[model samples]
Structure formats: C-alpha cells, structure tokens
Target chain A: MARLVEVDDAADPRLADYRDLRDVGLRRSLEAEHGLFLAEGEKVVRRAVEAGYPPRSFLMAPRWLDGLADVLATSDAPCFVVSESLAEEVTGFHVHRGALASLRRLPLPALDEVLREARTVVVLEDLVDHTNVGAVVRNAAALGVDAVLLAPRCADPLYRRAVKVAMGAVFAMPWTRLSDWYDALPSLSARGFTTVALSLAEDSEDLEAAVAGVDRLALVLGGEGHGLSERWTDTADRRARIAMSRGVEVGVDSLNAAAAAAVACYVARARSAGA
Target chain B: MARLVEVDDAADPRLADYRDLRDVGLRRSLEAEHGLFLAEGEKVVRRAVEAGYPPRSFLMAPRWLDGLADVLATSDAPCFVVSESLAEEVTGFHVHRGALASLRRLPLPALDEVLREARTVVVLEDLVDHTNVGAVVRNAAALGVDAVLLAPRCADPLYRRAVKVAMGAVFAMPWTRLSDWYDALPSLSARGFTTVALSLAEDSEDLEAAVAGVDRLALVLGGEGHGLSERWTDTADRRARIAMSRGVEVGVDSLNAAAAAAVACYVARARSAGA
Candidate 1:
C-alpha cells in the first residue's frame, strides 16, 4: 500500500517533479535527464497503475483521495493529499481533473522483438507534433495495430499532452524508437513484412489495391509538412495513395500525417483480415 | 480590383471585424449574428478567394499585399495594409501568417441538392469541436466524399478555427446544417442514398461489408466522446464498425470521430470503386 502524506505548503521541495509543467525548457530537460512523464486525471492514473507503470508519487486534493483509494491501495509510492488551491498553486494551473500521477518512463521494446511477433505495425518518420503522436497511438490502439516504431526526430509518446490526448493508450501500446531508419527496413522485410510507404506521388499504387494479401505489414507514415523522405520512397516495398474524387481538392494536397497514419492502419488491418 | 489602404492604428474603427478575436464569446456571437468567418494564412485566404467566397475585408501586412497581388486584384473589398506590430495588436497575438480575410457566409445547399448528385457524403452528428469539424471536412474533401451534412447540434463549420484547420475546405466543400435530421433521412433515401451509421454496436456489420456495392451513400459519424445518438442509430439503415485485428485490446474503444469519419469515407470510396 502507498503511504498517504498530507501536504499544506505550495512550496514543498518534494513536489518539484510536478512543478512548472508548462515551461518547455524545464519540462523537457527534466524528462531528458530523469526520464519521467506525467499522467493526468483519475482514469489515466488508474490505467498507469494497472499497466504496472506504478506512480512514484501522486498529488491530489484531500476530498478526491477517497475516490482513488482502490488505485492507491495497489501503489507502493507516496500519495500526497493537498488542498485544491494549494495543489493548483504548486502545479502552476488549476488541476481540473482532480488527481495526477508522475510515472517513471520505461525504455522502449527492441524493434526486432516487436516485429518478430507482429503482423501489423506502424513506423512513424519524424512526426514531431505531440497531439498527432497521441492521436496516432489512440488510432493504433483502437484499430488493432500491434505496435508502433518511431524513427528519429519523432516526439516522445509519453509527453503530458500526448498522454492526455491518447487517453493513456501510450501506456497500453508497445512502442520503440529507432536511431537508424534505413537499417531497420530490411529486418522488417526479413520477417516477411511488407514495408509500405504512404505518399501522394502519382507513381504510387492506389492504397486499396496495394494493401491486398499481405500476411505481415508495416505502414510507414511521415511528418506533417513533409511526406515520406525520398530515401524511404525508394526503400519501401511499395508506395500507395488513397484515391481522391473529382472536384474534391484537399487544399494542402494531403491529409494530416497522423490522420493519414490512422487511415493507412485501418486499410492494412482490413486487407490482413481479408487475406 | 480591390483598393488597398494603409492603416497605422490598431484601434481603427474599420478594423472592428478583426479586433479581439481571442475572446470566444464575442467571436462566437459575431459569427452567429453576421454569418461571417475568418480565414488566416496566405494559403487558406488564397484558396477561399479562388473558391469564390468573396472577402468582406482583409487585414494584412505590407509584405502580403505585394506577394498576393493577383488574389487581391480580384476582390472588391477594402484591403487594409498595416505594420506587423499593429496587425499583431489587433489580432491579440503575433500575426505570423501575414494575412487574414473575413468572408461572408453563404447559404448551404439543401439536403436533397447535396444527395441528388452525390455518390458519397458525410452526415456529421453533434461534432462540436471546431478542430475536429475542420479535420473531418478536410478529409471528406481529400477522400472524395461529395458533401458534408452538419446536424443541428454540430459546431459552426464557418467558425474561424474551423476554416483555418480545414485549410479553407469550408469554402470549397458543399455543406449545410440539417434543421430536421429525422425528416431529412427519408429525403436522402428518396435520392437513392443508403444511410450507414458508424457505430460500435454488437450487431453492426464490418465497415468493409457495409460499404460494398453502394452507389449513393451517406456515412453518419458522431462526436468523439459520445458515439452516435440512439435516435441517429435507430434511423440508420445499417450499423458498421471498422474491423480490428485479433488479440489486440483496443484500450480506447473509439477513434477520434474525425479520424473515424476519414476511414469510413475511404472505405466507402474503395468499396464503390471495387463495385
């Protein structure tokens, strides 16, 4: 069981990990050095505990503690009970969700291991937006994609906003970050997975036709502004596009990359099921 | 050709339409009363103009006036060119996009008009988030859904954020608010359209199967937080769900309604093409 500690001071040194979250530099540096991520709201905190990413500590209003008693009973960390105003003052914003948990960041799984057992996986290339990253994970979880592989330059999936937007699916899905994207493609192919790049190029096969009869597949998605890199286009087994109807012009000529990722994943899953 | 005027004051009476936009209540009320919406950035503004949404007026920096000379030449409205600082002061933030246009909202086509000529359309139900609404429209445009029918409870498709997020698709796509959703369904059916509601119900058919061989179709999508209402569900000719793979627990049982709408649109288009 976790130890319940009562805190009345807004300036308590023990709450440093939970402070100044909106300051990018301070938060990013702390994440980089200490490898910690925040899970906000009661539901996500409960999910974190269930996922075994047990909280190191929790900060909540005294009135809200009873609601979390079941989750707290299973946690081995310190639970701090504070006044709502004091909690707000300490955290630099009104904690509207009533409770928050700080969890230790876990190292990503090995790419080879994730690929070995997966039939459908997503490879994200340089997707930097945290909201997009979160949404992609949410889609992945919903549509039954087995895992997510992040290429270099992708944002952290455990970022606070990402966690909130994903509704804690980041804790549930298997994900890994790869430093070398080119070297990663052949191994995926070696596992009998087709490395499909999503692009808007004319030479690309229609997405509906390309996804047929694949036993194992990796749908490679790109960043927001830039589509997949030329290197990826050349390396992928096939490049595919969603067919567009007449008089319908996507003003920017493509869907948001995260939106594209979700569509691609759904297509891949459907194709796999058909096979 | 539009006349360009130089303005130095942030508080200029002519700039009333563009002032204090960060205030949600004032902006919403203005949008509701005047049936006007703002489009930001050079790309969106240019698209809006090209799509024939006449600009009521424009607030711009001197740099944009020179760059968008061709587009500016076509509009009859007054174009106020101000310094970047003054533009920022009026907009309540840095005007990095350099130009903004306010457009008078036009009447949407009747439901029968949209359905009569359409092979594929999206019927949105209570999708209240402006960003999600914009995203759905962008996807509908890209994926070739012929029109968007906004239920009464849905967000204003012409709200500033919706227009910007949609990349100006609000101006490009054929959309209208449905005053009576239940009465309108029979009209849609009269036009040879099959109304398929995207739901997660037990008896729902797979999305792939639901869309197969349907020439004229209207996909009903609901808000992200709440799935389709019972009333909407009861009216649907068919209930369909995106297929998920085995052994993957979809921790979050739903996709972002916009994302779901995109996938549904893609599936419907693919099925129609296959038929």
Candidate 2:
C-alpha cells in the first residue's frame, strides 16, 4: 500500500518535485536532472502507472485519494496529501485536477528497437511546441502508426504539459530521440524506409499519390514557422503535401504541424490498408 | 493613411477594447457588445486586415508600425502607439507578439448563405474551447471545406486566442452560429447535404466509407470533454469514426476534436475528389 504522508507545509522539501511547474526552464532542467516527469489529473496518472512508469511520488488533495485508491494500492511510493491551497502554492497554479504523479523516467528505447517491427512511422523534425508534440503522439497512437522518431530539437514528449495533453500517450507509444539530427532521415532511408517529407516544394506530389505504394513509410514533419529545412526536404525520399483547396491562399495556406501529421497518418494508414 | 496617436497611459479610455484580454467573460461581453474582435501578433493582425475585418483601432509598440506600414497606409483607422510594458499592462498578459488589433465584427453570414455553395461543411457542436474551434476552422479552410456552422454554445471563433492559433483562419472561413442547435443537422439534411456526425457509435462506418459516394458533406464534431451529445449523434444522417489502432485502448481511445475534424475533412476532401 502507498504511504499516506499528510503534509501541511507548502515549503516542505518532499514537495520539491511538484514545485514551480509553470516555470518551463526550471521544470525542464529540474526534470532532466532528476530523471523524472509528471502526469497530471486522475486519468493521466492512472494511465502512466498502467503503462509501467514507476512512480517517484504522488501529490494530491484528500478528495482525489478515494478515486485513485485502486492505483495507489499497487504502489509503495509516497503520496503527499496536501490541501488544495497548499497544492496551488507549491505548484504555482491551481491544482484543478487535484492529482499529479511524479514518475521516474525510463531509459528511452534505442531507435533501432523502436523501428524494429514498425511498418509505418512518423519522423518529426524540430517541432518545438510541447502541446503539438503530445497531440502528434496522440494522433499517431489513434491512427496505428507503428512508431514515432523525434528530431533532436523536438520538444520533450515527457514534459508535464505534453504528458497531460497526450493523456499518457507519451508512455503508451514507442518513441526515441535522434541524437544525430543531420543523418536521421538518411539512416531511415538506408534501412529500407521511404522517408517522405511533408512539404510543398515544387516537386512535391499530392499526399495520396506520395504514400500510395510504399510498403515501409516514414513521414518527416517540420516545426511550426518555416517548415522542414531545405536539407531534410532535399534528403528525404519524397516530398508531398496534403493538397489544399486553391482558395486556401486567402489566409490559411497551410495546416498547423500537428494537424498535418494527423492527416498524413490517416492517409498513410489508408494507403497501407488498401495496399 | 492611418492616423498615428501616441499614448503613454495604459488606462486611456480609447484602449478599452484591448483591455483585460485574458478574461474570457470580460472579452466575450466587451467584444459582443461592441461588435468587435481582436487579432494578435503581426501575422494574425495582417491577415485579419487582409480578410477585411475593418479595424476599430490598432494598438502596438512603435516598432511594429513600420512593418505594418503598407497595411496601415491603406486604412484611416487610428493607430495607438504604446510602450511594450503599457501594452502588457492593458492586456493583462505579456503582449509578446507586441501587436494587437481590435476590429469591427462583420455581421455573420446567414446559415443558408454559408451552406449555399459549400459542398463540404463542418458543424461544431458545443465546442467550448477557443483554440479547438480556431483549429477546426483552420483545418476546414486549408482542406477546402466550404464553411463551418457552430452550435449555439460553441466558443467564438473570433475570440482572440482562436484568432491567434488559427493564424486568422476564423476570419478567412465562412462561419455562423446556429440559433437552433437541436435541429441544425436535420436542416442540413433537408437541404440535401449528407450530415455525418463524427462519433464512435458502434454502427459508425469508417470515415472514408461514410463519406464515399456522398456529394455534399457536413461533419459534426463534439466538444473537448464529452463528445457529441446524443441528440447530434442520433440526428445526423450517418455517424462515423476515424479508425484507431487496436492498441489505442491502452490509453487514448479517440482523437481530440480538432484533430478528428482535420482527419475527417481530409477524408471528405479526398472522397469529393474521387467522386
């Protein structure tokens, strides 16, 4: 059974893992140094634990305890029961969901291990937004993409916001970072994967035509502002676009990166099914 | 040419339209009563202006004026120049984008008018999140969906955050609120459009199959938390789902509303092309 430690003081060092969550830089460095990530709310906490992430500790109000009793029973981690106000004071935001779990970070699987049996994959390049990263993961999971490969600059999928937004998909999906940003797509191509960069370069084919016949597929999506770099666009096996209606030129000429990934994943799934 | 009026005080009465922007209730009431909406950031403000949302005024740091000079020169609206700190003071948040525009809200198109030439339309049902509504609009616009119809309670697409996330697609797309939420889908059906509600109903056909052979398509999406209400799920001509990977039951069972809409729009667009 989990140890129920009642803590009244917001400044307790035991609550350190739960502090200053809104400070992105602090959380990033702190989480990185501690090899820990947080899952917020009851659903995400439950899902994270279920996905085999061992808990370092849990912080929550008394009311949330009853709802999460079953999950708590399975772990011996300390559960710090703080008052709602104290929880807010410590976390720098209202603990609206009333529960948060600080889970130990597992070593990321090797790129080869993740790609070993995968047929369809998404290779994200420089997607810096944490929410976008999580949303993309959720998209991949829903659409049945075999795995996800992150570029070196991609936002941490294990970041608290990403984890919360993903609803624990960051744990459920098979993914790993590419230490070598330059050769990421090239290596995938060498390994018999068709690396299709999602771009609107002149030579680009329509989305459907691009993924039509590929048995092994890897989609490369770039960051929000400028899109895929010229190098990646040139390096990839093919460059394709989710064809826009002609009138899109009026204001929105492009889909957001996460939305593009979702569309591309669906298209890839459809093509694979038909093939 | 626009008149440039320099202001030092954040409390100036003329700046009221740009005040307390972070307060949803305040923004809604202020915007609605004044028949105005705000567009933030250089790009979004530019797009809003280009889309012909006549500005009530433009508030910005002096640095932004030169970049938007050409756009400003074309209008006679007053441009209020304030320091960045003052901009933040009035907006109740850091105006990191350093530019904001309060524009007169044009009368929304009638429901029939929006649907008149639109073969592909999206009907949003009670989506309370501004960003989701904006994103769906962005997707619909990019994918060639003709228009968007919002349920009575759907968040205002012209709401500031929606405008910013959408990159001003809300201004680009033709959308109107449905006064009669319950009967909205049936009305679309009466007009010969196939109203496909994106739902996980057991009998729901795969999205591609649901849209196959259809000419006029209207996709109904639900809110962020609970999905489409029973009324919409039962009232539509057909219910459909984006097929998920079998393993998705481990965590997420569905896509976010905006992602779902994007996938559905892409599928609908493809079907329309094939037909």
Candidate 3:
C-alpha cells in the first residue's frame, strides 16, 4: 500500500521531479536523463496504476486523496496531500485535474522484438509537436496498432504534456527511439514487414490500395514540416496517399502527421481484419 | 492596388483591431460584435485574398511585404510595411510568419443555402476547443465535407487560433451557426438527407453500414466532454460507431471528437464515392 504523507511546504526536496514543468527544455532534459515522467488526472493515474507503472510518488489536493484511496492502496509510493493553493504553487500552474502521479519510465522494447511480435506498427520520423505525438499514441492504442517506433528528432513521448494529452496511452503502448533511420528500414523488411511511406507523390499508390492485403505492415509517417527524408522514400516498398477531393486545400499538401497516422492505422487495421 | 503605408509606432490607431489578442475572452467579444478576424502567414493571407475577403489592412514585415507584391497588387486595402521589431510590438508577440491580415468577416450563407448546395455536411455541437475546431474544419475540407454548420455553443471558426491551426481553411469552407438544433433536423431530413450521429451507444449501427449509398449525409458530432446530446440522438436517423478491433479495451468509449469527425467524414466521402 502507498504511504500517505502530508506536505505543507511548497519547496520540498522530495518533489523536485514535479517542479518547474512549464520549462519544457529543462523538463525534457530531466526526462532523458532520469527516465521519470508525470501523469496527470485521476483516470490516467488510475490506468497507470493498473498497467503496473507503480508510481514513485504522488502529489494531489487533499480532496482527491480520499477518492484515489483505492488505487493508492496498490502501490507503496508516498502520497503527498497538499492544499490546492500549495499544489498550484508547487506545480507552477493551476492543477485543475486535482491529482497527479510521477512514475519511472520503463525501457522500451527492442525494435526487432517489437516487430517480430507485431502485425501493425507506426514508424514516426521527426514529429516534433508534443500534442500530436500524444494524440498519435492515443490513436495507436485505440486503433490496435501494436507498437510505435520513433526515429531521430521525434519528440519525447514521455514529456508531461504528451503524457496528459495521450491520457497515459504513451505509457501503455510499446515504443522505442531508433538512432539510425536508414538501418532500421531493411531490418523491419527482413522481418516480413512491408515498409510503406505515406506521401502525396504523383507515383504513390492510393492509401486504400496499399493496405489491401498486407498481413504485416509498418505505416511510416513524417514530420509536420518536411516529410520523410529521401533515404526513407527510397527504401519504402510503396508510398500512398489519402484520396482528397477538389476545392479543398488545407494549405499544406498533406494532413497533419497525427491525423494521417490515424487514417493509415485505421486502413491497415481494416485490411488486416479482412485478410 | 493596395496603398503602401509605413508605420513606426505600435500605438497607431489603425492597428487597434490587431491589439491584445492574447486575451482570448476579450478578443472573442471583439470578434463577435465587429465581425472581423485575423489571418496569419503569407499562404493563408494569399488564400483570403483569393477568396475575396478583402483585407481591411495588413501589418507586415518589410521582407513579407516584398514577397507578397503580386497579391498586394490586386488588393485595395492599406499595407503597412514595418520593421520586424515594430510588427512584433504591434502584434504583442514575435510575428514569426512576418505577416498578418485583418479581414472583415463576410456575411455567412444561410444554413438552408449551404444545405441546398451541399451533398455532405458536418454539424458540430458545442465543440469548444479552438484546436479541435480547427482540425475538424481542416479534415472536413480535405475529406469533401461540403460545409460545416456550427451549433450555438461551438467556438467561432474565425477565432485567430482556430484560423491559424486550421491553416486558414475557415476562409475556404462555407460555414455558419445554427440558431435551432431540434428544429433544424426536420428541414435536413425533408431535404432527403440522412442524419447520422456519431456515437457509441449500444444500439448504434456500424458507421460503415450506416453510410452505405447515402446521397446527402449530415454527420452530427458532439462536444468533447459529452458525446452527441440526447436531443441529437433522438433526432438522428441512425446512430453510428466506428468499429474497433476485438479484445482491445478502448479505455475510453470513443475517439477524440476531432479524430472521430475525421473518420466520420472519410467514411461518408468513401460511401458517396462508392454510390
């Protein structure tokens, strides 16, 4: 069972992990080194508990501590109950959700192992926006994508905003960061996976056609600005696009990377089901 | 041709409409009464110009003023070319896009008029987040949704953040707010439209089956907190759900409203194409 600790001091040394989160650069640096991520909201924290990401500690308004007593009973982490004003002062923002949990992030599964056990996976390249990254992970979990592999330059899925936006699905979904983009392509292909890059190129096949009957597929999505690099395009088995109607220019040549990821994930899941 | 003017002061009276935009509530109130909205970036401004929402005035960096020479040649509004620092001071932020256009909101087409000419439409009920609103508009445009009808509680489509997030599709798509929700249902049904409400109710039909061979379809999406309202569900010809894979606990009952909107739009478009 988790220990309940009453904290009145806003500058407790034990709560350093949850401090100054608004400074994203510093927070990300901390995450990269310590592998600790924060999950907010009662529901998300509950899920984290159920998923075996036993919290290291919790900060919450006194009102929520009783409500979360059931979930807190399962973990041995110390729970610090503070006044709402003090909680806000410590977190540097209005903590509307009333409860928060800080958990140590687990090391991601090896890409080869994930691919071997997966039928549907998403390969994200250089997607920088934290919200989009979170949304993509949430969609992946919802639509049955087995894993997500991030290439160099992708945003940290464990970032606090990403964790909140993803509703803790980032913790649930299998993900890893690969340092080498080009080298990972052929290894995935050699594992009986078809590497399909999503693009709007003239020679690209329709997204529907590309996902028709592939049992094992890796749907590759690029960043919001510049899409997949030339090396990725050259290595992909095919490039596909969602068919768009006329008189509908959304300024960009393609959908937001996360939106595109959802569509591609859906198509791949649908095709896999049919097969 | 647009009259080129140079402004050196941030407090210029002509720039009143572009001031204090970071205060969302105040800005919204101003937009409501004045019926004016701001568009950022050269691409969105160019689209606005082409769409004939003639700019009331432009606040631009010197470099952007030179880049948009062709577009400026046809407009009759004042184009204020200022130093980047002055532009930033006037706009209350660093104008990274280097240009902004204030446009008079054109009279919205009547709901009936949009319905009369449209084969597919999206009815958004109380979708309040500017980012989600923008994303839905972008998806609606790309997926061949002919129009978007907003309920009273829906956020203003022309809100600056929404316009920016949408990549300015708010200017391209025909949209208007509806005064009556219940009364509007019959008029749509009378026009040979199939009213499909996206929901996850037990009795709801599959989205794929619900949209098969539909001529004119009105997809109704509800707010993030609540799914479709009870009134909307009662009025809908069919309540539909996107099918999820077996054995996956979605944790949440439905996709994010914007994600759901995109899926619903794509399904309707695909069905219409097949028909």
Estimate, for each residue in B183-208, the C-alpha lDDT of model 3 and write its tens digit.
66666788788889888777899898
> Which 10-residue window in model 3 chain B sums to the lowest lDDT?
B245-254
Q: What is the two-chain DockQ of model 1? A: 0.53
Off by over 4 Å in 1: A190-192, A247-252, A272-275, B182-187, B246-250, B272-275
The Cα error of candidate 1 at residue B132, in Å, is 0.7
lDDT of 2 by residue, A1-275 (tens): 78999999988999999999999999999999999999999999999999899999999999999999999999999999989999999999998998999999999999889999999999999999999999999888988888899988899999989888787888878999999988888999999899999998999998788898899999889999889998899999999988887454756788887888998998898784435
* Proportion of native contacts kept per candidate: 0.58, 0.70, 0.29
Clashes of 2: 0
Residue B4 Cα positional deviation in candidate 3, in Å, after optimal superposition: 3.4
lDDT of 2 at B196: 92
DockQ of each: 0.53, 0.71, 0.48
Task: Please tell me what DockQ candidate 2 reaches.
Answer: 0.71
TM-score versus the correct structure, for each prediction: 0.93, 0.96, 0.95
Question: Model 2 misses residue A174 by how many Å?
Answer: 0.8
Error of 2 at B95 (Å): 2.5
CA-lDDT, candidates in order: 0.83, 0.89, 0.82
What order do you get sorting by DockQ, best first? 2, 1, 3
